[model samples]
Structure formats: C-alpha cells, structure tokens
Target: MNLELPLAELTALLLASVRAAAWLVVSPPFNSRTIPSALKALLSVAIALPVVPTLVGKVPQLDTAEMVVSLAEQVVLGAALGFLTSLLFSAVQAAGNLIDLFGGFSVAFAFDPLDASGSTGNGVFGRFYNVTAITLLFATGAHQLVLRGFTMSYKALPLDGAMSLHNLQHLLTNGLVEMFMAALQIAGPLIAVLFCADIGLGLLSRVAPALNAFALGFPVKILLTLGGAGLAMTMLPQAVSTVVDKAVTAVMQAIGS
Candidate 1:
C-alpha cells in the first residue's frame, strides 16, 4: 500500500482539528489549566473526527497566500466563538465576584492560574460558582449543546464565509449587556441583604460610638454571606442552564447566524 489515501485523510483531519482545538483553547471547562495540553489536543482530534468526513472537498490548498488568509480567518472565527461562549459563562463567576466585593473577602487574594484574568481574593464566590456551573454544564447536557453549536458551524459558517462587521458588533454589544444582567440577577439579592447589614451596622455605630462596629461588621457580613450562599444554591443549576443556552446562541451569532 502506498499510503496515498491515508495521507490525504490525515491532512484533512489535521486541518479540521485546527478549528476544533482553537475553539477549546479559550472555551471554558476545556480552557482550564488543570487539563493538560496533550489531553486538549486529543480532545480536539476526537471532536474533529466526526467533522472530518463531512469536510470532503472543502479543505483549502496550502500553497497560496489565499490559503494562509483562510487559515487565519479560521483561527479568528474559532477564537471569536470561544470568547463569546466564555463571556456568557463568566456571568456566574461575575455574580460570585460581586459577592466577594461586599462580603469583605476582597482582601484575601491568592493566585489561581486556572482563572484567565482575576485576582486571588476576587474568586471567593466566583470559584464556587464556576465549579457549580461546570458541573451543571455536564449534568444538564449543556456541554453537548455548546459543542453541537460549534460543530454545526462547518455548515452554517463554511470555511470561506465572509464575516459581517455589523453582525459582529451587534453580537458583542448584546453579549456584554447580557453578561452584566446575568451577573446582577445572580448576585443582586445577596447584595441587597449585605446593603441592609451595612445600614444596620451604620445605625449601631451611631447609637454606640464606644462599640467597634467596623470590627463587628466583618463577622456579621461573613455569616450573612454563608447563609446567602446556601439560599443561592437552589437557583444555580437553573441559572447556569439558561446561561449555557444563551452561550450556544451567542456562539451561533458570532458565526453570523
């Protein structure tokens, strides 16, 4: 056997793998540093396997400047989709970050390499929320939805579809607004409670200037936060499901669908 057919097949598979792997590089749960590079590469190949057969006659020639431009476009497309997915997913973490802000946990910063951008102290609620969101992503099959949305891009977007700037701007603007809205929805109740606590502490300080209200405020807020966290648990899975669904939609929109 000359291995000629096998070589062409491998080439196609590798090209498809580029898009898949590039997507995972910035998409959450997959983008985590805890997962080894080797594992990510394997996962990329695994995901691309199904797409490879469908890509017949569509692989671009590697010998021209046009091909280089096309490959660059593919990378950009994958990165854009991945980033949009991640932005929505971060809503959960944003809620948690909000909690940290008022819970007096802001000063407890530590390094978390898995976090793409954030201080250590900023993740108190964010870390817990992220872990729960990731769990829900798998348990509720949202991960599958996200992957399907991405895989479907081969048809909806095509290897050579021209990107529309207006569509890209529209998706990004809407996505940012949605992200902050989700964050506030998740964290607002707790923030309101904390605000009440602060007001109460302020009144107490006025009534008893001898007492250290500032010192008492910290423990009281911590207790409230812990309690609020338990109450928030019931809302987490559902909120995560909604966010993941929106992420899939955003990914589709990112590809101009």
Candidate 2:
C-alpha cells in the first residue's frame, strides 16, 4: 500500500492546520498557561484535519498571494474569537479593581499570578470569585459551547469570502462596552454601600472636631468594606451565571452573523 498527497492538496491542509493552531493558541481553556503549548497545537491539528477534508476539493488551489491573504484572514478570525473569550475574565478583574477602590483597599496592592499585573489588596475575594465562575463555566459545559462556536465559524466565514468590515467594527465596539458594563453591575452594590459610608463619616467628622477622623474612619471603613464583601459573596452565583450566559450568547451571535 502506498499513500501520497499531491502538492496542491498538501498545501491546503497545511494552511488549514496553521489557521486552526493560531486560533487555539489565543482562545480559552486551550490557551491557558496551565495547558502545554505543544498539546494545544496538537489538538488544533486534530480538529483541522477533519475540517480540511470538507474544504479540500471545494476551496481554490492556493497561489503565493492567495495563501498569504487566506492566512491573514484566519489569523484575524482566530484572534477575534480568543479575545471574545478573554473578555469574561477581564470583566471579572475590572470588577475586583472597582471593589478594591471603593472598599478602601486601593492602597493595598498585590501581584495577581493569573494577570501577572498588580491587583488590589481586596482582590483576594474577587480572585476567588473569578476562579469559581471559571470553574462553573467548565462544569456547566459552557466550554463545549465555545468550541462549537469555533467550529461553526468556519462555515459562516469561509476562507474564500472577504472578511466583513462592518461586522468586525460592531463586534469590537459592542464586546468591549458590554464587558465594562457587566463589571460595573457586579461591583455596583458594594460601591453604593461604600459611598454611603463615606457620607456618614463626613457627617461624624463635622460634628466632632476633636475626634481624629483618620484614626476613627480607617477602622470603621475597613469593617464596613469587609462586611460588604461578605455580603457580595452571596450574589456571586447569580452574577456569574448571567455573565457566562451572555458570553456564550455573544459568541454565537458573532459567529452566526
């Protein structure tokens, strides 16, 4: 038995595999630091193999210019999908930052291992909440939904078609705004409580000139912030659930449209 591929067929498969691997490197679950890069590449190749078969005879034979153009398109599609998944995590981090700012922990800074960027001191709870949300995302099969979206994207945005500039602009604008809005919603309750506490402290300081506002306000604010954080934990499940649902919906809409 002999098995050999023609030059044209080989080139097409290679192109498809490269495109798939590029997307996987930047997308979630597969893109995590915890996952080995080699494994992610391997999985991308595995997925691309089947997909390429469907396109092998259908897609045009590649020339140098065409190959370059197609490769660029694939890179854009992959990066966009990966960025969409990452937005959820970004929203979580932004919410944590807001909580820290309002909770009087802005001065307390710590490095987040996941972000590698400096996070707030009050972020311990926020980080824990993020982990829980990510866990639930996987446990509830939301990760599978993401994978399905990626697969469907090939059909919707075939390599031969021109990328839609309008769709790209809409996604960029709406996706970013939605992430920030979600973060604000998650942090709103705690921020409101902290605002009220500041007003109360202001009233107390005016009433008693001799009392050291600095000494009295610090402990009181810390206690109130801690209590608010504890209460916020009770709302985590519902908030996370809503966020994940929205993310999945956005991915589907992006790919489908």
Candidate 1 lDDT over 1-257, as tens digits, reads 55556544565677667778898999986898878999989998998787777675676665678667767777787777888888888899999989988887765555456554553445578778888889888788788999998888877766656567688778888989999999999999999999999999999999997898999999999999999988988999889989888988877776656
lDDT of 2 by residue, 1-257 (tens): 88775765566566666667776887665666677888887887786777775566545556778778777777777777767766765677678778877776765545556445563344654556567666766888777777776777666666665546676667667878988988888888888888888888788789986887757888887888788778877776677667666666666667765
Q: What are the runs in model 1 whose C-alpha is more than 4 Å off?
A: 6-8, 110-121
lDDT of each: 0.82, 0.70
Error of 1 at 46 (Å): 1.2
Winning candidate number (TM-score):
1
Q: List TM-scores for all candidates, in order.
A: 0.91, 0.81
- What would the TM-score be for candidate 1 when compared with the true structure? 0.91
Question: Which residue pairs clash in candidate 2?
Answer: none
RMSD vs true structure, all candidates = 2.7, 3.4
C-alpha root-mean-square deviation, candidate 1? 2.7
